[model samples]
Target chain A: MTVEKTKTRLNIGADPREFQKRPSWTNEDILALLDEEDGTLDPRIYTDEDLYRLEQERVFGRAWILLGHETHVPKPGDFLTTYMGEDPVILVRQKDKSLRVFLNQCPHRGMRICRTDGGNAKSFTCSYHGWAYDLGGNLINVPYESEAFCSDFNKSEWGPTHARVETYKGLVFANWDKNAPTLLEYLSDATYYMDHMLDRTPAGTEVIGGMQKWVIPCNWKFAAEQFCSDMYHAGTVSHLSGIEAGLPEGMELSDTKIPTVGYQFRAKWGGHGTGFYVGEPGMMLAIMGPKVTEYWTDSEAANRAEKHLGSAERARQLMVQHMTVFPTCSFLPGINTVRTWQPRGPHETEIWAFTVVDADAPEEVKEEYRRQTLRTFSAGGVFEQDDGENWVEIQSVLRGHQARKRRFNIQMGKGRSGVGNKDFPGSIGYVYNEEAARGLYRQWIRMMTEPSWETLGP
Target chain B: MIDEKMRAATRQGDISLEALSLQHEVEQFYYREALLLDRHEFNDWFDLLDEDIRYFMPIRTNRTRREQKKLEYTKDNEFAHFDDDLTMMRGRQRKLMSDVGWSENPASRTRHIVGNVLIEEELSASELSVVSSFIVYRNRLERQVDIFAGERLDVLRRAENELGFKIAKRTIHIDQSTILSNNLSLFF
Candidate 1:
């Protein structure tokens, strides 16, 4: 292969020769360096469009992307407008008691049909014109269907195309690919971790409040990478010590534990466990607030946690802080918040957050849920608001020409990986290993090089 | 002549109280409650509320005329405003006193004004249900702040000494739909 730079494309300085030579993007080729004892990540992964578009097609298009929670659309005609892999989507409850996902764009002029965040709509008429469709995405009326066109204009053919919709527990997922894996299968080992939350309740969890949406100025990766045992940033880019005032009465927490959990498990396939930061429940119960502390001690809290969580004396300790579902979502069980970093441009992403509570919980319990969510994840949240600013500033500096020349480090506990250990799930160091980030970018390299997913599976 | 008339006159409402009587008493009771809050005397405020007091502020949501969706986005299970107990109120106050509580540090100055008192009815022998319109002006460093006006439906009962009607409960009805400012830190 001729080795050189491409002028039109941003030559992110990763050995460009590899892209010219490789025909198929296989897991093995990228996994090749992933297991290398002394390998480094190229910083180009932050900005390369070729790799970005591929990820949109392969990862997001193929993976079970979380559209919106079921609570957002409880009744028939309830609709929420969201995006499924860059395709504008409308998640609505159908007359058949099933959920439907459809392209929000009009079939005629391709204008977006629904512009609002959420509402109960019997039918959506295109804002540009009057092309109307129902919850089922069947074209019922067009302003000029009869007069402007011949009977040859088939309204049936022009109806919005619906995407594949499925659910794991209560989470709704949309797949652009018709032949994608089942939602449960796509979840894999991630299910094992999720069962602790979903199985805890006999009726399953219900989203109490609707979703909270916020935007951050960073690549989607920055938000995704935050779940990968990145506690090194705890004391720097965000607040680890600043918010720790005193707790209520009968509370005690020295600055000993980490705020988020730290665990990384390899999927039966290639998916990994969300590594949580390690904070103790004693601290959370005390500092989070009084109403919250009472809910944690309540019997339902334990009865639910026990069904899915294995019998461990300390399982309900609230120690597993950041229980992330890697690649995109981060579900913090302690605070009961669901947030997604949906990538907008290469440098910007929307941080959509939702607060969850038990559907059957008492009013006091729900009130506590609201308080904890607001204190931790609201617009003026103690933790999130601070980190978002840093993400914005970091991307600003990285995208600058002067800052682009340097390569940053991902090598945490070097030479500590590759050799397997008992406590950790992956073939890396301990549970709080940097191997997840290593694994993520390695997968990135594989996708960038390979053609379509002709080389997937074990 | 006014003092002589007050000693013998009945209240504007019917069915006069058989208990203590003093014109200056009710005004002082309100003034004292405002003083306790303005002074950040949360302990005194806690003492003022009856043990069985019901405190609530339902969330307000914009609903179409046909549908009556409960202001609760959280399925009508939780309170949108303060629904607190004695212990919880004390805990909140403790947090405010803490050194690290940034929102309360150099605290936003506040002044409570009460007027247009309407004695609705004598709820009980000792308890009086009343409504008063009030305006509280609040300002911090960065932003100009003001709470225009609201009516407070209050149940006032004679304190242990029976000197006057002490506020047993207060429910404020704010006219503004939106809480444009951040947190609801102080009492209305």
Candidate 2:
């Protein structure tokens, strides 16, 4: 009960803006990136709180977010609790067995109705006053409905406020904006790469286990950008493991790990990027050479596993680790898992990772797939923890007023462009370039400077 | 459930240490290993690992007996985190040594106090098994200090000449479920 009065309220419904801390993004700010010299990115993106609030409204609110995989809710009455850019969202199975997503806040007093992370409940009960709703998220009961309402209370009219829930392949997507493009339309070429992730399996992909969530203190942009292209800081500022993995130690920027071990692609299609050692030059191809198969073996075994799961064509198309969905979803196709990052505040983020497995794959393989997922992406996995320290430090250091002043450049391997394999599904840049981060900033600019979907007309 | 193999080894298996001669060598070896880590002598600490050493922090989980489906630690279990192999261990050590391994930049001056070293007293001649308790306290820059106290079960195997009886594997079982607030940045 004490958490009630002090808990940060989600209802900023009508509060006048009074938090005078930092400057918001302006058109001039985005245009600066167009210049080669003065257009460098300000480190303020990592620290500024006002910029974050604006982003939540401008970018996250507009982007088509990856919610969860379709495999989660199989039959009616099932539901899973997750957050979309910090808004609690409930993914439910309707009576028709179709899946739907809604804002998890109870319509009555704006209280979060469900506390359990996931469950198979017949209806939702608001813990505060026991206002209950059926599995369809329709208000079904109140302790004293007769006494409280004057007989005209229409539960149908008070049904859940709907969110735009859709999916591209097996990956479920939701949008706060009503008129956002179809998940596939928004995905565009990004979907081409997604096919390698989703369609490759025979029975299609399903979220294998419960989501992995960890609280991180960093700007969501910082975390999201880091997921795709913070490769420039690889050996030095970040990986303590990199240093331990025999990186010459110093705090020098150059000492940081470079994405040199992999290639990077900045997709022009959906403003998303995929960075990997999936045959990109300069990578430690020798060590990863034999195990090129997404999971354990070579590409052949990978293709074979794909065929075993579904179709040969699907397996052929999608056999690499190129799955970073726009805005927030990152799928390591090779690892067969998708990570959705929910930004809570300017300094805090919660990451959710879900692995996908073939429905028809052998139980041992499914179990093996589970083990493989554990090996790396899980919170305690080597790379997972390795990246955590850096993200945390990135969040913590932005606290410095002076330290946040200098402009950080994503100019690495910039002019080394024009390297594209037209046959490939997504944009291809030189392996290990920060071009992906540049693409992120570019999309960010579009969202910030663009008009709202409502005024633009349907 | 603890693997039947590890438990049986503790009961009877490749756990003979008479060849390495009881507490003396085992105590000295573990003490030396801890010293190398605390001192940041990573390369040297690496040398102490018997070439074939299997250094692992297999996850620790809380599984209740009455659960319908007898579940053990799996990938889905919330993995607080772990490190495996000399590569990762030394990787952490190297990061700590760096000017901005910030986690330990203001290096925590530590004293690894170890005690109650005991031999399993019943295993094969080639293997030497031992158990010891430890408390390591770390004090670094402007943050709260960290300490981890726990028991270690070790299996040492004698090798050819230059490679003497060395750690075949070392598994750390903490006294408490929660790690002492510090991420285990160093090997125990």
Candidate 3:
């Protein structure tokens, strides 16, 4: 191929030219930073700029990132503009009711084809050059094409790049890597944990409100890793004040006791992970108000969930659960606050969060879930306020050269993980463990170092 | 007192002396509220709200100009930043004052600049519809500074209290769709 052809292919999201612009850090150097067995992590991983760029290309580009729900664009012409890592993409519903995600950039002049967040659009015309694309992201018209361009100039050859789309229950996910594993294969054992919220009822789930977004000056991994493996924060000190203040009338802080019976699941294949307290409702009552707690744990809604999931543990017992589907998608099951930790840079993350509810739920139950999630997990949430503070402080501290040179400890529950839990699947460990964190970093190293899907694919 | 005669006169753009005095009193009430918030007198600030006050700040969205009227802001019963009743506000106050509320433990220094005070309508003999613009500046931990500019639609009611008026309702409309601050840890 000519150099011009190669450049065109690169711009249109063909196999990225990883070998030409390789960073100084080798596979061995990246591997040395993370010691999975000893459970230690070098602080440089959170602060390095080169590593961040590699993550965007390798991890986010290959991973099946959760974009939105099916209900987000239920109609034929509906669309939602969101991000796949730093790359802007438009998720649109076609005339056949199928979903497609394509780079929002116009292939001609590289201007965004859809500037609005989301709406029904039969065709998107680029505001900069008047190049038009159909809902499927096919270039249909170029202004003065017959007059200015050669007769052989084809619109099909200049369409924006498209990503592979898939849905697990109602959640829509998109992937740019054609060679990567299918969504289910990539999710692996994580699906069992994801179903606790997404597939709790036969009616499935629907997003409650418009997305709530805010920027936190912290690494995306901090938010992703905490959701994946750090239930330890909740059981201990991080949320005590917020929980105490949110307790219902007649309930004292002293009256509540932390439940010790819970398990954390680290996905055996993928980096996905979740931790939940079994048969516990006290913490749920504090975080998600009483009405929502009742709806989630004791109401007919709970009964329906148990019947649909075919297990009482998944339906009624897993309270205040947190999970991350690898990279950036994270959510809380009972609270039903789903979010993507969109990485802005090495030191900043934009959080886009939304609540979801069972479609068949009563209006009051749905409303309660909406209200409770806002109070507990949205941008201005009492509990969420504490989390951002911790992440921001840690990121700020990493600004120091001395701070970036130190090796941090990740040895919370190193040897306690094993398989064969009856109610759960994948590698099981105690709720307050860093086993999942090890799994997450382990996967991160593999993605950062491996050049192609031949070695990385499941 | 804001009786029906005065309200009718104000509505007709007559600008009665009572109307002028009431407007001045309303503006002063806002300045006093701003002072309490800036001084970290949260309890005193709470006292200025009615027991049944609805403090709401809805999430905003980016939509096409044609759809702005319908989809620009989240509707009532939808997710919002601060959809608080009295109980919820009290809970927030408790968290703000608590020892372990790390977000506020080393409390942020803030300036609540209130301006553009407008009494939109006299809804009833005791209640008045008011609108005001604000620019809140918060500086924390040496160099972290966040400036929030927003307009508030408020319902102020005459009350037999020290402040002479209670904020019965407030709907905050922030200018940005995506909040730049890490968290809305402090009141707007």
Per-prediction DockQ: 0.07, 0.14, 0.77
Position B63, candidate 2: lDDT: 32
Error of 1 at A78 (Å): 2.0
lDDT of 1 by residue, A1-458 (tens): 22122113454566556657655434444344333255454344565555567678767766567776787788999877788657788999987779999888998889988876667878888878888998899998988667788867888898887788997778788877776556776666567556544555666677755555546657787777765445455433244422352244454324335444344543444444444433345445533565665555447666555544654332354333454454676666656777666877667777666767666767777767775565555433544544664566667777764354344556665556453533333444444556666655554455445555456433
What would the per-residue lDDT of candidate 1 be over residues B1-188, giving only the tens digit for each residue?
32332333235643333212333455567677777777777667667777655444433333333333532132334323444545445555554555544445556677778877665666655666777887877775455364646778888776684334555677766654334334455676
Query: Chain B TM-score for each model?
Result: 0.73, 0.68, 0.95
Which tens-of-lDDT digit does each residue in A274-354 have in candidate 2? Answer: 655433321121112223333433354456655554544334333334446667888666567678877878777777776
Write the number of the candidate with greater TM-score, choosing between 2 and 3.
3
Q: What does the lDDT come to for candidate 1?
A: 0.59
Clashing pairs in 3: none
Name the runs in model 3 displaced over 4 angstroms. Answer: A1-23, B4-9
Error of 1 at A369 (Å): 1.6
Going through the candidates in the order shown, the clash numbers are 11, 13, 0
- Order of all candidates by lDDT, from best down to worst? 3, 2, 1
TM-score, ranked from best to worst: 3, 2, 1
Q: Which digits, one per residue and each the tens of the lDDT, describe model 2 over residues B38-106?
A: 787766766666656655443443333432133222233223234245544444455555665554555
Prediction 1 TM-score vs. true: 0.67
What lDDT score belongs to each candidate, Candidate 1 first? 0.59, 0.60, 0.87
